[model samples]
Target chain A: MIEVRNVSYEYIKNSPVLDDISMTFERGKTYAIFGPSGCGKTTLLSLLGALDAPTSGAVLFDGKDIAQIGDENHRKDNVAFIFQNYNLIEYMTAAENVSLTEKIDPLPYLLQVGLTEDEAKRPVLKLSGGQQQRVAIARALASDAPVILADEPTGNLDEDTAAEITKLLCDVAHENNKCVIIVSHSAAVAEAVDQVVRLSHGKLQEEV
Target chain B: MSIFKRAWTYVSRTRKKTASLCAMMCVMLLLSLVGIMLHGVCMDASQNLKEVLGGYVRLTYSASNDREESVLDEALAAQIAALDGVADYSGISTYYLSAPDVQLVAGSFAGQPQGQVPRFVGCDKSALHENFIYNSFEVIEGRHITSADEHCAVVSDVFANLNGFTVGDRFEACLDSVITQDEAMPEEVYSLEIVGIYTIHEGWEITPMTPERDIAENFIFTDMQTADAVLLAEHGVEKPFYRQGVIFTLNDAERLPEIARSMQNMDGIDWENFELVVNDKAYRDSAASLQMLEKLSLLLVIITFSLSGILLALVLTLWIRERRHEIGILMSLGISKVSIWKQFLLETAIIALVAMVVAMTLSVPCSRMLSEKAFDVAETMAQSQAEEVHDPMADVMEKLNPTADAAVDVVQKDDVHLTFAACITIVLCTAGIITISVTLSAVPMFRMKPKEILSDVN
Candidate 1:
């Protein structure tokens, strides 16, 4: 489980982006962070992924603050991230892109994420938006991290592809015993997850 | 993934950029190789010249003085010979005289008796042979003159041709001096047999103050006994005398002044009538050229580093900026910053290594061309200077000894190695510059937050 305690984040002095907020994300569950634009959904995901520090709070992974656990070691062993717009390296093949996070064989994870052997070997730039998204999902899953933080994972995909991506994330959380956090504005995406949290004006509240 | 795999992936992926970097590295390596090769060649040549020139001492004497009264006396010669670090010493006396009638051609020496104008050279024959001074003589007809042949002489090809004489030819001519009542009286002369004929190689010819004077055609050689005999018969001298000047060859020319001062203070000698001259110009010129090369090499190295650094910085800066999105994606995926940095550095090192190998391979021709050009310029200048002075060919021939010949063997091999090492050094230096520049450009990325890197993409 990942825990946030009185977390506040600021880009500049006295200009906070995330106000005092506390939340818990349990293992073996898919959680969605739904918010309007500029509601700090992405900032929350970044902190959870250990990409940044909180201004005055604790981000805990398994009862230990992620910051005190060492940023590099925490990121390397505990979390994975998937970005919107399919952030696959253009120069690398889909399989190579997926392998960027994996400590072992990436081909099986690529197949698990629904990429054919030949399609996975093609350069990521040559793949369609939907296929690229799957590759990013493969990369995150291959990391074998306990927690996955994804920001707008299906932002660039069509409805069918978005549904497939959401299903994949839900399956990974429930079947693989992982905690998955999806930050998105899409209501469809939020409804597909096991739990949903609504964020507004730098504050978080549980949804009914 | 392993660092090797990552490095290989980046290298294979960015073919165009890698190739461009390699090309730049090759050029730098080639320049360095050429510079090193030329420096080696110049140093070798200078050393050879110094050894051949016998440490920069000139032999000179006054023409008006008699042989016995000259500085070439046995006592002074012995004193100089015994001086510290004196390699060897020899006293040589030379003058001109007419050939005998039987040996004389119609236009030779204005039809005087074949004057045995012998030069009195007092020297150890073994030292002269070891130095290769006498070895330069190519005996086309008969044998060389030995100390055993006190009266025998070696005649040059030019002298033999003008006199209509051959080896073993004995001739006699009048020694009578014509008396000009109001002017001067003619001196007596002697007859001698030509025992040998020799010719000097073209490169060995010495250019005299008079452009038309050829030493081979004009001079005849014999021992001091013959020279003393001729002087006595013609000028009526009994005791042996010498001219005012003496030429000393020492182990080190830098010690000449001290040695000269010591000689000047010797008992019963006239110091004001003579001056000592050390031929140190060759050494001085070589030293100056070496100093200039050192300065120029330093400047070139600094310029190369500065220029390459700026270029590399610009390339890395733009490249890293373009990869911001990738950096954010990778960091978010749990790739450590240090690994990211290593990947970038590895990519550059691969590019630089490939470039260095190519540059080294290409530098063979480049270094050869540069060395040849430098040699040509040196040769031309040496030739022009030779033309302005005394017989340049003779000067070169006299100086071409065993020491220089041995030095040449060493130079050819060492010069090539030196050039290759220089090329390697330059390439390594270029690699260092690239590393520093890349590291500097990567610093800003380390401080950036993942959101900041990803915001642009959003």
Candidate 2:
């Protein structure tokens, strides 16, 4: 489970981006965080990813504050991130990029992500947008992390690819028994998830 | 994956970037090697020149004018020569004589003294030794007149040939005291053996004001004892022993004044009546020119190092900026800032290794040519300036030579060859500079937080 306890963030003093936000995400569930632009959706993700610290309160993973867990251990052994731009290493082949995260065959994961053996062997840049996104998801899944954090994973994908990615993310949460939290501005994305949370103007609340 | 693998992949996969980086490192290292080689050659040459040519001050006292004073003579010069840093010395007494049967091949013989026979001046052993030591005069036949020889002479080649005189030939010469007017002075016609024959390579005329200065070709060199014997016989109980002026040479000409000052503190020498005159033009010129070359080489090294640092930093910084997305992605994947930095530095180090190899190969021949060319340039600069700019070192050389043209030959004979030590030094220095530049360039990136770097991804 991932928990945000009275967390607040601000780039400048006296001007808060995330204000006393609180939430809990359990395993075997997918949660969509929907918000307007500049509503601190990415900032919350950065906190959960241990890339930054919340100005106040704490973010916890499995009842332990991320600050207490140490940054590298949390990111490397606990959480996996999927970026909207499909942040794959440009020079590395799809298998190599997937292999960067964890010690695995990577070919099996690439095939599971619907990638051909030939496409998986080539550089990530040689793949299409949807194909490259699949490589990023494969890399995330290859890590044995129980929690997955994604920022606008389908924002750069077409409708069909986006639906496919959503289904994959659901499977990762439901079938693999992982807590998957996604930050997006889309209402349809929120409706497809197990739980819907809206971050409106620096405050978070669950939709009825 | 491992840091080494990531670094290797980055280096090999980015061909254009790697090539440009390697090019920058090669240029910097080559320039540094050249600087080291040139500086080493110049320093070595300077040291050898200093040893061959000494620097010194001449001390003399006036006997004619009442106001003129300089409490100096052979004894005092000996004391100074024995002082810590003195290298070599010569004390000379010059006397004019009129000898029958000796050839005067120098200038017009004019009249008097049988009106047919030639008369030559007498030069002491000290004078002969000075000229011989500098190669101004070479004893072509037989040996030189040593100080132990009381009645001996080394005739000049021109005079010896004209008079049909060789070694072991004896001749008569007369010396007149100042008091004697027309009266025939005592017979000091010491039948002096022609101990040696010398050819005057160049003449000594350090003091240009005196028209009758000691010229190498005219003087019949003898021992001081013989000259004094002639002087005493001619004086006829008027004077006992005459004193000669003292000249000294030091191991380092630059310290002439310092040694002179140290000598002033010695006992039995009146500092008020003496003034030390140093002619260190030769030493100073060579020393100064070498110093200039050294400083120039150092400046070149400094500028090259600075420019290399800036250029490398710029190229690598741009490289880092271009790879910001990768950095952010890596950070998001939990690679840690330290790992990223290590990989980056490792990448640069591999490129530097390749460049160092290229630079070392090119540096060997390149520095030799540059060092030789640099020597020629400095020598040419010395030659180009006649009077508007006078190099004391060149002037001293010219004065020692028979003709001024020989001095130019002296300048030309200086050669600079590369050495193993120079190459080794260049390699070490190149490696040090590249390593420092890489480390310093990474400092800024290391201080930045991963979140700060990852912000660029947005």
lDDT of 1 by residue, B203-257 (tens): 2323323221123344456555666665566667676444323345666544656
Give the top-scoring candidate (lDDT). 2
Show model 1 residue runs off by greater than 4 Å: B53-55, B59-70, B73-122, B125-270, B282-298, B379-424, B456-458
Best by TM-score: 1
DockQ of 1: 0.58
Clashing pairs in 2: B282-B393
**Judged by DockQ cut-offs, is candidate 1 incorrect, acceptable, medium or high?**
medium
lDDT of 1 by residue, A35-61 (tens): 888888988988887888899999999
lDDT of 2 by residue, B244-263 (tens): 45567778756777888887
Question: Which candidate has the top score in DockQ?
Answer: 1
